[model samples]
Target: MKGWKNPILLVLGIGVSNIGNWIYFVAINLLVLKLTGSAAAIAGLFIIRPLAILFTNTWAGSVIDRVNKRRLMVYIDILRGILIAIIPFFNSIVPIYIIMFLTNIAGAFFGPTSETYITKLVPPEKRKRFNSIFSFATSGAMLVGPSVSGVLIMYGSINTSIYINAVTFFFCALAIFFLPDVDEKLSSEKVRERITMKTIAEDWKAVISFGKTATGFMIIFLMFQFITLISFSLDSQEVTFIQQVIGLSEKNYGLLVSLTGAGYVAGSLAVSALANRLSIRMLLGMGSFLSVTGYLMFYLASPQTIPLAVVGFIIIGFFSPFSFTGYATFFQNNVPVDLMGRFSSSFAFFQAMVQILLTLLLGYIAEVVTLQTVTVAFSAIGLLLAAALMSLIFLQSKKALFILEAENNLTEEG
Candidate 1:
């Protein structure tokens, strides 16, 4: 199989799988809220899935590298489909929690393993384009997925959305059939050497802590994750702010979220064009700066102004892909390919762990403090962290732009 075709198929397949997640999440959150009328329960459900992912991602990654990534993804998708199909019939909170737990198990394996396959299939030179295309595919699905899920719940039923999620997962599994074996020709000896969790963890530790550059990158990446979680967790508050100030309905929340996704699509397009010209360090730094401004705008919006919030979301979407894609590409470039799955999984685990903590923390703040106050405070904290991380990137590298120069040198040598 040619390179582009494989990545394209992978993106579509993964996007299809993500739609299931999107549907399940929308249905569950809305249903739980309708049933219990409790924010804490809603938050609990959101937090539990990521917490499960945090604990399992490293182990999942280890398994992925040693086993067949394609098969693992296929089985994971199928299992998740069955789990979703089972969820709607059982209305008890206990059963719902159990099904959600199972979904998290599948998510932990599927996401990192698929990312590992992408790292292998997509060359460094083509990552920007590939990520842009992939981001657009997933984000586009996300844009539609929630609205469709909402419609299914509003018109048909919550159970209908669950059924749709199951079908989507099955289709996702079928799409996996098109994926080539990315680790196709590994020798028996090498496979045997990599079988243990300890071996993979050790490998991951070495790469992430390899030097100041690697460590610094990881720190900054962690901050990036923190900021993203804080921002997303504010979704409800954002809608509240709009409602209180401008008298918009809760429905506009979806439109604003779609705007954010649209911003991501726009950013993805630009990153595809400009990433090769910019260093990863430069891209991340600028992305962080834009995010700070965007969040600030959202927080400071006046009572009569809702468009400002929309603009802020648009800016976030536009710049977020640049930072995210740049970071992922940088990790791929710096880390050894053999350890890619482990390193990616470990990195993802830490990010998820932080997000889980922050979700609870931020939820508390939103509850105890005013949402406006919470939004401003966290947005400021996120902005400050972004600036600091950007400054450190330049300081540590001691070069204004390293990746572009490095790539140019490589090109000249070639």
Candidate 2:
């Protein structure tokens, strides 16, 4: 609590930036739809996001540890703000897609950089609480952002909504500008290391070596990556699923999304309120189970019960605090702050690679097969994956218990 100045400001900036993102998230798709009238184009944007990450994340992580996080964030925010602002003026699809892709490339730098900054600023003891609060604030923004965007589009224009998003990004930059520097010890050698393909490869090699030494950490990391990979794959098709199969309008889709955001807020607040009593196992394992179950429900949803999608989304949203916040704390506690950037960004690189391949494949599949069938198949597969992950967690726990018991016995004999 004493040295919370940096973390607080950082979280504030993150929340502001997230609000802007959610605000424009749907609007951007609608903009593309208006231009091309192709759901495939919308899904194509999802692919672009991961492709940008794959192109940037490895080098971004390698260099992040050598740089000033605050300055980097501010610069990227300004760049993204400018890019987003100009997006409204672009009448051609090619220019719009290019701008969006570049904006995401800039954003790739911000995400890992911000995560590493938070790890440095926030104390391990308070990390979980801070993340819960951060997530809660972000979710609050999610609840209101799309609604605001929708209303602005209804009363004003999509261009106006996009401009609002642009403003928020600048606001975020301003907010972060005042934060005291939160950084780790930057190596002289690191500053000299230029960004290159070799740099990424070397960093990944180091990450692999580090993970090998800590089997438990490696397992948890893989779990996180796999879950995200599965989720993002579905995300590429989610909007299409909502509109076509579920028979919902754009406004109703936003409404149901807001409901899920409300659930996220509730879940985060509950975790924050009960931080003292909750154990990581209960939070991570049980949380995964519940979140996955909610996803399963959505995957199995029918048009007759389309209205019930909100309930499933809410349930999934409700448990995110446990899975996301728990993993954040887990990583902070286990990984070195010096290597945090590399560990995070390298993992993201892998996740992006997985998402890129899977999203393209799934997108192709969705074109030929019914979108609903694809949705349910993937959702059902996600459920099975969750079950397998839980088994891994169970085995890891048993292994730890056995090691602890052996240690105790050895101590007693001595």
Candidate 3:
């Protein structure tokens, strides 16, 4: 318990912020709809996030690595809080979109900075357990956040939920403020490098060089990211598939989402309890394979087989946390903290580009082809990727990469 103090606080802060984000998501959508009465406007909101990532991540890593991450995180949180707080005052959709994009830019910075900070704060041996706990916190927030937002909107107004989200950001900032500055010992002189185009170009080259040298790690990382993107594309079309193709009512669709959230909560609990017993190899391999299988099942189910779809949702919701915990721990363990920001941001830039293109392509294809056909094809692709991921995970040559500590190699071989 004594050793868990910082991790606990960190998880709490993250959990709070996640809940606020969900609340803001619901409120902002409602606010937009109320203002413009356009579903397309809400859809446009989705595009802003990746666009913000593309705009910021190209150079965000250079700043992330050169600054004190903890202080940077605190400042970003405060900035986001201020931005979100003022969103309700805007009656125009364009201004709201602009502000949302800026807020997302701050969020883009917060992610890698926090990841680097977590690596610095948590020891290698404890990272698996810490990440499992973090997943549970995230799952809880997913379940509670929208429900809380719904109640607030019912009792008060959308502005109330938005303001509450801003409050949560401030709360998160306060929580992060108490955390130790892990980079305090590093000389200020070492971190004061100028952020010229030459420096940024050199950083990109270094990240690419690292990827070339660490092919195994890059393969696993990119594969998992592709799988996630497929899932996202499917999710973007979920409502239409459920309502139009499956002939389900909106009420039933909401029920299905709730059940999926319940499954996530259950899975997070299981991961937290079994963190000590499960190996990273098993977590990554089995978790990804099983989760993709669930997606495949969901994609194949028809109106007459709603139960099958329900089961699929449960399986995916339950198992995804396992994959997430494994991958996050693996990333932190393998990547040198000094280079993590650059590696994460650089790949994230490429990912944003791919995401925008893939999402638009899928949406276009779904209109031309049947949604069923498009979904089935992409999910099948995910299945293949999962198999490839599992093969990579189980390879004997890569066993050393997953070990939590240098001395723990003996345990993973079994």
Of candidate 1, the 10-residue stretch with the lowest lDDT total is: 405-414
* Cα shift from native, residue 243, model 2 (Å): 6.0
lDDT agreement with native, every candidate? 0.73, 0.77, 0.88
**Candidate with best lDDT:** 3
Error of 3 at 360 (Å): 1.6
In candidate 2, stretches whose alpha carbon ends up further than 4 angstroms from where it belongs are 184-189, 196-198, 236-255, 303-310, 360-377, 394-414
61-179 per-residue lDDT for model 3 (tens digits) = 98898999888999999999999999989899999999999999999999999999999998876888888999999999988999999999999999999999999999999999998
For model 1, residues 1-414, the per-residue Cα lDDT tens digits are 355877777788878877766887788887777777888888778667677876677666666667777888888889988988987677577778878888887887877777777777777777766766776776777777887887888889988988888998888888887777776787677667655657766766665565345554456656766767777666546666677755667778667777888888788778777766777667777787787778878877765676787888798888877777766665556555666667667767777766666756876887797767888888888888888877876676653322322342252110
List the candidates ranked by TM-score, beginning with the highest. 3, 2, 1
Clashing pairs in 1: 263-317, 264-317
Error of 1 at 63 (Å): 2.0
Question: Which candidate has the top score in TM-score?
Answer: 3
Task: Provide the lDDT at 112 for model 3.
Answer: 94
Question: What pairs collide in candidate 2?
Answer: none
Residue 386, model 1, lDDT: 85
In model 1, which regions exceed 4 Å deviation? Answer: 1-3, 33-40, 189-213, 232-236, 243-248, 273-279, 365-370, 392-414
